[model samples]
Target: MDRVFSFQASGVCINTQHHLDALCVYFSDRDQLDSLEFYSDLEASLKSAVLLPDCVVMIASRKFCEDIKEYWSNDVLKASFVTRGERSGKPFIKYYYLYCWETSGLVEVFSHCADADVKPCFNLSICDLVQQGLYHLVKENNVVQIAPVGHLFKHPSGTRNNIFIQARELAKTEPELCFVGRSISLAFGFERFAKLSVVYIDSMGIYHFVQEALSFCKVDARIHSFHSYDEMRKLTPPPIEHLIVISASTSGGMARDLRNDQGFSDSRILTLIDKSDSDRSGKVLIALESVDKNIFDFEADNFETEIELVGEHFSSKAKPPRAVTLGRPHTPPKLLKFLKEFGRDGLNSLNEIIDGQPKVLSLVTEKVSRNKVFLKWLEEEVSWNITVAIDTVICTDDLGSIEIANTVADLISTHKVGSARPTVCVYRNVDWSSVSNATGVLVVTAVARDGGLLREISRDLRENLNSEINCPRHYLTAVGLPQSKETWSRLKQFLERNASERLYGFSEWLVLPIGSDRQSNHWSDLAALAKTSQVVEVESSVVSKSVVDASLDLVSDAIRKGFNGFLPKTDGSDLALSSGFIYFGDVFKDDLESALHATSYLAIASALQKARDIDDVANQLRSTGYESVILSPECFLRFNDNILHACILRGCRKGELDYSSSPHHSKLMGEFLLKVFSRHQLPYGAAAVEFAAALATQRLKLKKNDQERLVGKVVNSLKDEPSALLGLLLMVDLPRVSMLSIK
Candidate 1:
């Protein structure tokens, strides 16, 4: 009854290196040998061969020999085999079996058999033997089958015992594996060593399984259990970091839901199923196969292998992120400075202004011509380069006076030799316009001594030319008149007596006298006349091209300065109205062209002088209905002083003042009007009374009765004047008139 297993050589001697004693036994008809007897013989031979008591024995089995279980020892193992059975005409029945045994002596036996030269009687290799042993152990209920950490494992309810314990033991090396089952209750033994979080998505209503898992998984890991996906979705669960254990019955829906709804694309998932659900086409198998790797029938002992495979696979597939840059590396200092001064918007404006020609050229030209200081300052302090082309420079010869008819006829004959550029024909004391053939000529006539020159020039340009003139004709004038002491004394006396006399009419006849005292008296009289006259002109009586050129230089300088000031502040299209002087001359017609240019400096000087005596000027204007007129320095040079003065006075009386379309000029006129009204005394008339009353009401925000009383007082004050009766009639209301007995 004692069984023995024998290892014998089959006469196939193979030479091999060896360090231990080797024994081989020949076997004939090995299938007929008794299993227990063979095992006993093998053990005895192993002992005789000086092998350790730990020697192992292997048996090849052709069937599932249940009777051999009684004789099986720890030192005995079974190699796998296949047997076929034929029953009449029915299909053959095939059976496969494998088994293994392990003890303290197993390693010793393996070590002693390391270098045997004889071939073994069995046909199984070492790999075959190990696989067969593992297969047999998995088939038997002695060792529980465990799945890989991230895979589904199924077993019968009876065979679920010791599964968690084996998994915990495996977790010692590969900590990711933790087990939960109803039959086996094992606390998370890894709790003291490491912490983890387990999310059990229990769609199958496996509440008992969840409770058991939570209880057994006593590690620092937190176990969250939800019966349905909707319940789980209510709370924002942390990312599934450690593992997600789902029942195989619901694994497909759970996986799909987790991916589609919860955005769980990368969570490690484990599934649990029953042994009866082993159909490959089952939901559990399909779900497991759909994932990155299918981990089925995973043993706790292979936990490290499973984790390593998953770690390598995921690590290989991981992706990481990218980077960026900005702006220019370097900027020039000059460019930075420009940006700081003008800014990007301002620079664009400046570019536009430069592209458009400016409008204030003529006014600037006139202002520069009269002032010697401005002329000098322009030449030296303010650097300006200019080019001048003079077609003619007519001077007063020793002949005393030039005849208008002959001079024009001779100039016309000479100009017959036509030139490419336009001719600027200059003349003095002559009616140049009477010459009918003066086509393509820009005539600049000096009208200071010619009484009819201005009238004739106007007539010719307006009527005689027939629009044949290619360029505009202008009248040039000197800035101021010279005066002798005796003449200044006489003029001063005349002005003192007749304050409203047209002063510019006689200004040309006076000369600054030879003596220093006479010169002082001459200037004094001129200043006196300037303060008294409604309109006055001061001129140099020195008309020449040099003066014109100097005037132009100052004008250019003013324009440059104005542009420099405005460019940084404005967008090119619109500039400040106050700065209109910079482009004032560009808008002029030929009528005032020369006058405006010639008198610009003098007008500015006179304006400055009036500014200095602004209080006195304002008082005088307010007392009388008088406007302080500062004519251009050359105003008398081009037009008869008396006629010009009369025209201006008439314009003012009619409430007509021309600003030549210049805002700066318009502003100046407004300031003059304000000064004139600053302290105006009401005249004795209904209009004056009403004006006073309205002004008071407006200033004080007065009511009806208060305003009427004020008006009555004003009217009473003017009762002696002829217009006061009209004032009273206009002032009284019907009720008040009845009380006053006015008919």
Candidate 2:
């Protein structure tokens, strides 16, 4: 089945002795998953099997052997630790699974726990079942490809066949919210209600989103949410509004009442019935006609209040991203001009830095790709970071240069310093599935190393993958001849015949660099080019019409390189650490809130890590802000004042604070405000004036009382007006309105 999912970097390890020990045992247990023979002498059995991919021997007694399967998973490296006998004191048995592919020619071992002295007792009986040994068996069995691909599919070995089991059934499923309105604007705004109510909708997500949205606007709102019809009937239900939102299964009087009631005659209630209206509505305007807000706000926000909801949204890395703020939908010429300047460089630098205009100019002259232009524009136009972890074959030995096979197994592969990574690992030698209790996937080429397939099994998760989202593990292998200059003449013909999964497991296609002189060298050239070249952002609308740009680095390691991340370990609560922004999309769908939390943490971390580098901070936060969270001077100062010392260095003019480096972070700041305003849509005048002042790297000229008056005028302008979040932002200063008003 074709599956789509978002996954983050799960775990990372440093190349150290202690870490190696842990990994050794982790891979060894993988080797023993298939079969293990019983033995009368436990110590002798363990000593004999210690060097095998899995160490399955008894240190205590034969009773421990049967129960060992309980602990068998992709997580633990150390299989078991026990005393030699009832009389023996300290534990002597140390069994672990080590991935031998990473070891070029040296003897290696992997184990759990950081203990360093554990030794492996080698025996030939154990080696026969090793993954390296299994590759020979699979070749002999004539089921090499089909056997590994079957690992990802959930099948009852005894009874069921091809009965598809979905990941949704395994975890807590939150059905998508359905708050349909007359226009997209309303749909976008109402989503914020979910978190504010904190209503647990195991399936339907409409509960708390509504409440959270109101809170963003500093309004107190509540959700009288119900799980079932019986529960909903008990609550004093409010009159149905003209437009309402509900799940698909829920219909009947509830919807009719909303449409029939004179009060809700024109109201249109959005119901989540099918995937037809799946797109999220971004901006919304709700008319308030009654003082009885008991329907929404139990005590506050009476008839006098008008609720407006906006969303934090931006196009996919368009050039001059500010040109398309929530305020309006047209792309201004000035923005076009800025994009033209930004795109002078050709490297796709979505979230990367480029020094000196001259070098950038040279690259543009050499050549340009659409992705290169888009990435360059995004980097220059928006406060966003982009990370793309592509699978490439730098060095190939074990297979037909299937580097993606190694790359896709990153959840199971170990990163070792001063180690050579082959294009592919042994089939079962390093591949294993159904480990750690989470669905896992792997891929392999025709070349064989025994234990590769066993090493990649990782369905057993330390903590069950998040139930809120659905992501299953799958393994794909690309089958073909060697990629070389000699194969260029027949490359296209070969690819057309080989793309079929009937022969392998996944969609098999080769990525070739456009400028390449030969077709067969396409993947090689592109991979090398991506690795070393400086990426530059570009700006442009989608080639066909108005759509998100193509090179919208949705998930790239370069962007999420360094930040504290949350991982679901068996311990449950996130194993939070400074893990360089590992994103697990399988567990969490990345939304504006997650983006804010991550951006804030990264900004704070970067600031604290290099307190002296004002320039670096300025550079990292280049361009503009986001629509997800507010990052104005006031907000940033309020949230992160501890890390930011008051700007003591005076500028050339009095009252003008000057930093040793650029203090302007328009892109980053833009990202923050865009998100917050999308939900809150705060008005402007004095506070807005003050924020704009920061954007321009200037000081506010208005006095304290006057500042309040200006702020009030800006805010009151929005009191009753319904506008998009971007509309609210672009009107911040009224394009010289403040200056004219002050004059």
Best by lDDT: 1
Per-candidate Cα lDDT values, in order, are 0.28, 0.25
Could you estimate the TM-score for every candidate? 0.16, 0.18
Output candidate 1 Cα RMSD: 43.6
- Predicted candidate 2 versus true structure: per-residue lDDT over 243-355, tens digit per residue: 24443221133334334442333223444221122232311122111111222122221222111111111121211111111111111212222223222232222112223
As a TM-score, model 2 comes out at 0.18
lDDT assessment of candidate 2 = 0.25
Report the lDDT of model 1 for residue 443: 28
Score residue 160 of candidate 1 by CA lDDT.
19
Candidate 1 — worst ten consecutive residues by lDDT sum?
318-327
